[model samples]
Target: MAKSILIVDDAAFMRMMIKNIVSKNGYDVVGEAENGQVAVELYKKLKPDLVTMDITMPEMNGIEGVKAIRGFDPNANIIMCSAMGQQAMVMEAIQAGAKDFIVKPFQQDRILQAIGRVLARAEQ
Candidate 1:
């Protein structure tokens, strides 16, 4: 089965861009959220195989969402999405329990690679 993914981003364009890439590459996008708060709620309800989360958002940021989700389920597979220079926040996301991260303006190969690596960890 294809991995089910929750895509969270405040920008509609970003969400669509990611969806197109992952779906074409054989991942199932189970749900989408525009903010971390909604992401957390959807996570509880959907329990997707992986999540691609944006770092900056209203209501709650990705770091806080990562922490909250990890608090609920330690093994949740989360991959943080960051802009060009958010290295500090990306590190924090990892420390908060994100499995990995992908830098945007969405490189197709990198995004898919990150998903593969993060999901593959579950097999071990």
Candidate 2:
């Protein structure tokens, strides 16, 4: 079965870039959100196999969103995606139960590799 993924980012362009990369790699894009609150809601509704979340967003930040999702579903497969210089927030996201973190601007191969690794580990 194709892996389903949900992408969360404040910038529509960033989301598009990610969507282009993931979908082209043969994954199904279940849904997308422009903020953390919406991401959490969509997560509950869609139950996608994986979620790629941005660090900073309106309504709630990525770390907070990660916490909410983790609280709602302990087994959630979330990977944090952030800009060049948010290492501290990245650590928090991981501690909040995110499976991994991918720094932006996302390199296509690196992004796919991170997603593949997370999904593979989750399936095990």
Candidate 3:
């Protein structure tokens, strides 16, 4: 079965870009959220196989979302997406239980590769 993914980002264009890449690569986009709060809620409802989360967002940030999700589901597979130069935030997100990260201005191959790696790790 295709891996189900939840794409979380505050920017519509960013979400669109990620959606395009993951869907074309055979991942199912089960849902999307504009912020961490919504992302957490959608995660409960959809229970997707993976999540691509943005580091910065309105309402709540990706690190907080990762924490919230991890609190409920310790095994949640999350990949953080952030702009370059936010190494601090990226580190926090990973420490909060994110499996990996992809930088913004994203490349299709890198996005797919990160997703693949995170999902593969979950299987082990």
Candidate 4:
């Protein structure tokens, strides 16, 4: 079965871009959330195989979201999405339990590679 993914981003455009890429590449997008708070709630309900989370959002940020989701599911497979100059935040997200990160504007190959690697790792 295709891996299920939850996409969390404040920008509707970003979510659509990611959804298009992953869906075309054989992943199932199970849900979408506009912020960390919503992402956390969806995480529990969806229990997706992976999540692609955006870094700077209202209500809560990616780092906080990572921490919250990890708090609930220690083994949750999450990948952070960051813009340029957010290396510090990206590192923090990784430390908070994100398995990997993708820089925007996202490259199709990179996005696919990141997802493939993270999901593959989770299987082992």
lDDT of each: 0.91, 0.91, 0.92, 0.93
Give lDDT tens digits, candidate 3, residues 1-124.
9999999999999999999998998999999999999999999999999999998899999999999999989999999998954778777888999999888787898998898888888999
Instruction: Decide which is better by lDDT, 1 or 4.
Output: 4
Q: Show the colliding residue pairs in model 2.
A: none
* lDDT tens digits, residue span 1-124, model 2: 8999999999999999999998898999999999999999999999999999998898998989999999999999999999845678777888998988888776899899999999999989
lDDT of 4 by residue, 1-124 (tens): 9999999999999999999999999999999999999999999999999999999999999889999999999999999998854768767888999999898987999999999999999999
Model 4 scores worst on lDDT over the 10 consecutive residues at: 82-91
Find the number of clashing residue pairs for candidate 1: 0
lDDT assessment of candidate 3: 0.92
- lDDT rank order: 4, 3, 1, 2
How far residue 5's Cα lies from its native spot in candidate 4, in Å, is 0.3
The prediction achieving the highest lDDT against the true structure is 4
Clashing pairs in 4: none
Query: In candidate 3, which residue pairs get closer than 3 Å at backbone N, Cα or C atoms, i.e. clash?
Result: none
For candidate 2, what is the lDDT? 0.91
